[model samples]
Target: MTVQHEPDNWRKSSRSQNGSACVEVGSFGDGAAIRDTKDRAAGYFTADRDQWSAFVAAIKGGRFDA
Candidate 1:
């Protein structure tokens, strides 16, 4: 998540290895854009910088423990 990127430079996570069932992330200004690798034309889900950072932080901190 520390990497900076230009628009449209989508990259799927390296941890993804289960067929095409994964997502891709790309930078959009200080924010980011995400889309399904299985369906590129399905549109995207976006998050601004703050939201993106918080989300990542939560994951790293295990705030989503089930």
Candidate 2:
């Protein structure tokens, strides 16, 4: 399997508030990266373009809503 690298320009989620559960995202050449805003030193995870798209779609479709 191919490995993905973290992106350079990470930005906090727009829906994030002044809370400890916030996250940040960054876009790489062919994918995206996600990291914890509260523990940046913990590093991050990356998803390829297709995976990222699917995740976003699921979110929009409320697949993750409580």
Candidate 3:
């Protein structure tokens, strides 16, 4: 998925204790953008609302554990 416009309100994950290994999330009208906190210039990936919801659900369900 691609974001049609630049996302706003970029913020890092609350779980980020140290700055080394973290990601930042930004919000657009239709979806969200995620990028490496250590490398903002590397760009970001976007996901539509549904895809983002599913991804979050999977994470909460431990689908990505390990």
Worst 10 residues of 3 by lDDT: 2-11
Give all candidate RMSDs, comma-separated.
5.6, 2.7, 2.9
Clashing pairs in 1: none
Clashes of 2: 0
**Count of backbone clashes, every candidate in sequence:** 0, 0, 0
Highest TM-score: give the candidate number: 3
| Candidate 2 C-alpha RMSD relative to the actual structure | 2.7
In angstroms, how far off is 26's CA in candidate 1? 0.4
TM-score of each: 0.78, 0.81, 0.84
Model 1 lDDT, residue 32, Cα: 91
lDDT by residue for model 3 (1-66), tens: 943777768988676797567888889677789998778899999898999999999999999999
Relative to the unseen true structure, what is the C-alpha lDDT of residue 4 in candidate 1, on a scale of 0 to 100? 48
Question: For candidate 1, lDDT tens digit of each residue in 1-66?
Answer: 675454568888788897999988898877899888889888888899999999999989999999
**What is the TM-score ranking, best to worst?**
3, 2, 1
**Candidate 3 local lDDT, residue 12:** 81
lDDT of each: 0.85, 0.85, 0.85
**What's model 3's overall lDDT?**
0.85
